[model samples]
Target: MPEQYLKKILTSRVYDVARETALVRAPSLSRRTGHTVWLKREDEQDVFSFKIRGAYNKMAQLDADTLARGVVAASAGNHAQGVAMAAQRLKCQATIFMPVTTPAIKVSAVRNRAARVRLVGDSFDETLAAAQVFCEKNAQ
Candidate 1:
């Protein structure tokens, strides 16, 4: 598993969609703790989360045929937006399945990224199952 992660990190193409976030010192926190502290500004990303890096990297690694078959993910938060944005950038179709209880704003965000957003079950487990079924039926 460690070796697989190392290979993925070395081959990642995240920079195609994500910039290198800055690490800035936290002056107040450092002063209070009497130790140097730094903050990775992942929130500054286009998706406002580091999930974009992993999402883009995974898509980037896919072959042309796989990409053509499309991508699907189950998420309601930042991961949804990340996968949507990555699919748009790669010119691949993406289906994002979110729990029915997810807020409209999150769904809107994923849709804005040009992904097909589906409101599935009311919980994460249910949503995941729905996505899996979709993938199996679509051969994605």
Candidate 2:
């Protein structure tokens, strides 16, 4: 990675919304690989995914005007939850485009975070296209 970008990441305020999850010993994986191993306990997060770090960091860096205008995203599960969580923290509206086939649990999770949910197409690609079109139409 470039030095400038690395510095930005190092200085990120991602912790404002994201927890520093632990690295837990992974005995099973270690046994299989015949080496010591550890797994990041990202599932310990409120969103239950490490996806929240990136989502929160990206949103945190957005200009206030842009945040006021709201944010949009496309995802089938974790990423949607991450964005929704970040939106709630940042006090920004979020519209998440998800595939129609996405599980009800995940959809409910996004809504529970106060983000509007848009059930789009059957595949990730189609859902992404809908989100892109929405961004273009809204001039976001």
Candidate 3:
């Protein structure tokens, strides 16, 4: 997509929200490895990760009718939180799936975003399968 046209389609407020994220220089890692290293400081985000940026960006593009129908997504960590936050901000229902072994931190992160969290299967693949089934059944 053309960058300028794409920018116009997205709401300015959402972009503002994402812009608060920091881009931290990786001084220690760079020095240790003798390589250029930098970290996109998504950890400073409102939800404490980069997920919000992509999630909000995607949800912000959905039409009203589709938003009313809600959205479903499967993710293990950061992406899940991002999707959940985006859905909540858009006032669209969100269903998220995480593997059974996902750390509590990740699960809590999504829950804190007000996104419904479901623990299923053992690996990302299995969790994704369950999420797909749920989405199909829910008609999301």
Candidate 4:
């Protein structure tokens, strides 16, 4: 399993949607701690989060049939935006199920990424259940 993970990491297709973030020194933190500190700028990604990489990589590796059937995900935060953007990049139809309580800004962000957004239940679990049902009904 470790070898498989290593291979996946080595060959990940995240670059299609994510850039190689830099490690930059944190001057203030370093000074406070009396030691060197570096921060990984994952926020440099197009989605402004590291989630895009994994989302894109997973979509990139999907079988043609699966891609054709499209994808469904349940998220109300960065992951929703990540999946939406990844699906757009892959030219695959995507459905994002977000909790009804999600902020309007976040919902708009996910919608702007070109995925079909569904405002479902108020909790993550309920939202996830809605997504699962959608997947089953749509044969995703």
Candidate 4 TM-score versus the reference = 0.89
**lDDT of all predictions:** 0.93, 0.96, 0.82, 0.89
Model 1 residue pairs with clashes = none
Q: Residues 21-110, candidate 4, lDDT per residue (tens digit)?
A: 999999999999999999999988878899998898889999988988889999978998899999898888888999999999999988
Stretches of candidate 1 off by over 4 Å are: 1-11, 32-34
Model 1 agreement with the true structure over 39-113: per-residue lDDT tens digits:
999999998999999999989999999999899999978999999999999999999999999999899999999
List model 2 lDDT by residue over 33-91, tens digit each: 99999999999999999999999999999999999999999999999999999999999
Scored by lDDT, model 3 comes in at 0.82
lDDT of 3 at 118: 91
lDDT of 4 at 10: 75
Clashes per model (N, Cα, C within 3 A):
0, 0, 1, 0
- lDDT, candidate 2, equals 0.96
Worst lDDT run of 10 residues, candidate 1, spans 8-17
Ranking by lDDT: 2, 1, 4, 3
TM-score of 1: 0.89
Candidate number of the best TM-score: 2
lDDT measured at residue 123 in model 3 versus the true structure, 0 to 100: 91
